[model samples]
Target: MKKILYILVLGGLMSCQKEKETVLKEDIQFLKIKNGLIESSYYENVESIKPIDGFIPNDSTAIRIAETILYKVYGENNIVKQRPYNIALKQDSIWCIQGNLPEGWEGGVFYIELNKNNGKVEKMFHDK
Candidate 1:
């Protein structure tokens, strides 16, 4: 009787394992199909999309782009400390962004100059 009980338990465990494997395979196949559909749809519609007027159209756009790069190169905390950034347009097509220090603070800030029309980074440096 004990041997028979052990055989039954082992069989149940094997069946459960097989069920899990089947579910996993189904999930993987579903993900593959969904991914393929999304990719194909994007490619078909991408060419019809209109081009943007300018890569860095405004001051806010320039700031967002600068912050993204700054966060990656410098730590988030370090970059956030230098708020109230100074932004200017040079030659009507270049964005000049510089980080600012708080009152009475004395330290070098990050500076980035890029082309507003094409979104090209012409110069980037952090003052020491």
Candidate 2:
């Protein structure tokens, strides 16, 4: 009976350690950074390293362009928190990404506009 009790306790401890390790690994996989741009999968798939061509704009392409332009104005800390941007392509090949601003800011939602043909930022503004 004594030997059986000791074995059970050891098994439980090992299982607990494994559980902790799994949690840590999961946390690490939640976020990733590339090309000095930090994006996380914890909330949404917000970053795309792959480059696209032509006048078509997908979530990855729009995000990559938007983040690049936004990064110049705001640091990674300010941008990463605004994930899962609401994106749309409007008339004249305009690709726009609208993300929410942090609390206590003057604006509520930030609008980032880009020319789909050349990936050039046309305008960036926010709703007051």
Candidate 3:
């Protein structure tokens, strides 16, 4: 029993140690130059989501980057709409935020605030 308890404790610690992603304010490129995955879509999920982009970022590729961070924080299907807002590459890397969501038919609304300096975001809570 003691050994089992020890293993359980270790597992808990390991699972809780989810590494956070850090996005620099100056290193964000809207388009993926490495794999040439620009103008891609998350057709697997998230429907009715119209294509949205901005100037300087012809395709708002920053959204994909932001979505990656959000997915890490809140497992799949948590972020429903990952849209970019206020995308401007002025001197510093563009700073933007997106909305996330829970499972199906959730009337409740949720939003995620972006922290470009660290490239991570926490779920913003509001009273229903």
Candidate 4:
């Protein structure tokens, strides 16, 4: 009888755990759907829903993204050497990130042009 009770308790616990997992999965799915709806609304042209704008909305964010890319392409030391990165938004859709060289510097700095709305790297190169 004790063994049977133990088995039943174990089964109940297992079932509850499974239920919790299912609920968690459902919650995650709901959140994804909700977020998708919000994103879709941004793209829609309806009067109620605002038109889609560029994604990398600000200079700070653009700088961070550009730095990350630069770090990957040109090692940390190289990126550090070029301090004070210049970031600008052009035509309301392009993020232009350029590395600034110190005074009397002759080497080329990193330059990256990315799409603000889609975060796509349109062009990337490091000057010599």
Candidate 5:
């Protein structure tokens, strides 16, 4: 009984959560910095890192870009909490980015990338 209890306890601790969080990229990318993961982080299958735009200021002098290291430290789906980050900006375009780092991620360096339409990163990175 004691051994069984120990195994169960360890198993529970090592298990992941199941939650649902959505990042539409277009719908919610306005002056917002998103930092959450989707279903999984599988290569080529990883969630996209897109840009968000908010009501652009009327002044419209220059854009500011920021970046932050993002990580999915816990959760499988139903609920997720990610670290705060900055956005990277250039020219008249704006963007928000989220990417996973290596095993020892304390948060990596992030730069701005423009987001355009439902296109791929390459296509979106240059959209104003």
Candidate 6:
């Protein structure tokens, strides 16, 4: 009986660890886009941006970068329809921008941290 109880507890812990790992993996996939660059749709419409030679995007431009990918994934008028909030520049030229869910939405928020020098996203995640 003791051995059986121990086994059951161990199994439960392992399952919980696996679930945590899966959530992390999904978060990574959701944030990262192919080649870590803006898709063609943004270039087609936004003349200020250059895809090949990435620009040093500031607070406003960082929002554009986030929106470029968000618009692609969530469509033009979806979760990202509203502008990102709390755009701030951190040490080492890292720019952080957050997109919030619609009013009364259950989900918490999405964050994009990018480099100011080359406009490359260092990390992105959706928080619940």
Best by lDDT: 1
Tens-digit lDDT track of model 2 for 26-110: 7766555556555534547456454455554566878887787777786666677676678888884888888865567564656
lDDT of each: 0.85, 0.74, 0.46, 0.83, 0.35, 0.72
Which candidate model has the greater TM-score, 1 or 5?
Answer: 1
Rank order by TM-score, top first?
A: 1, 4, 2, 6, 3, 5
TM-score for all models, in order of appearance: 0.59, 0.48, 0.29, 0.58, 0.21, 0.47
User: What TM-score, to 2 decimals, does candidate 3 have?
Assistant: 0.29
- How displaced is residue 57 in candidate 1, in Å? 0.3
Q: Residues 52-78, candidate 4, lDDT per residue (tens digit)?
A: 766677888888888888888899899
Q: What TM-score does prediction 6 earn?
A: 0.47
Task: Give residue 34's lDDT in candidate 3 (0 to 100).
Answer: 55
Please provide, for model 5 over 1-128, each residue's C-alpha lDDT reduced to its tens digit, 9 standing for 90 to 100. 99999999877765522111233443344424436543232335557654464333222211221121112222222111222323344354444443333456464333234433332233112111
lDDT of 3 by residue, 1-128 (tens): 99999999998877666421223322345334556554354334546533233222432455566556656766546554423233443334344453534346444433444444334343343223
Candidate 6 stretches greater than 4 Å from native: 1-54, 81-84, 101-104
Candidate 4 minimal-lDDT segment of 10 residues: 34-43
Q: What C-alpha root-mean-square deviation, in Å, does candidate 1 show against the real structure?
A: 12.7
User: Which has the higher lDDT value, candidate number 5 or candidate number 6?
Assistant: 6
Rate residue 13 of model 5 by lDDT: 62
Query: After best superposition, candidate 5 residue 12: deviation in angstroms?
Result: 79
Output the lDDT of residue 55, model 5.
36
Give the worst 10-residue stretch by lDDT in candidate 2.
48-57
Greater TM-score among 2 and 5 belongs to 2
Pairwise lDDT winner, candidates 1 and 6: 1
Clash count of each predicted structure: 0, 0, 1, 1, 16, 0
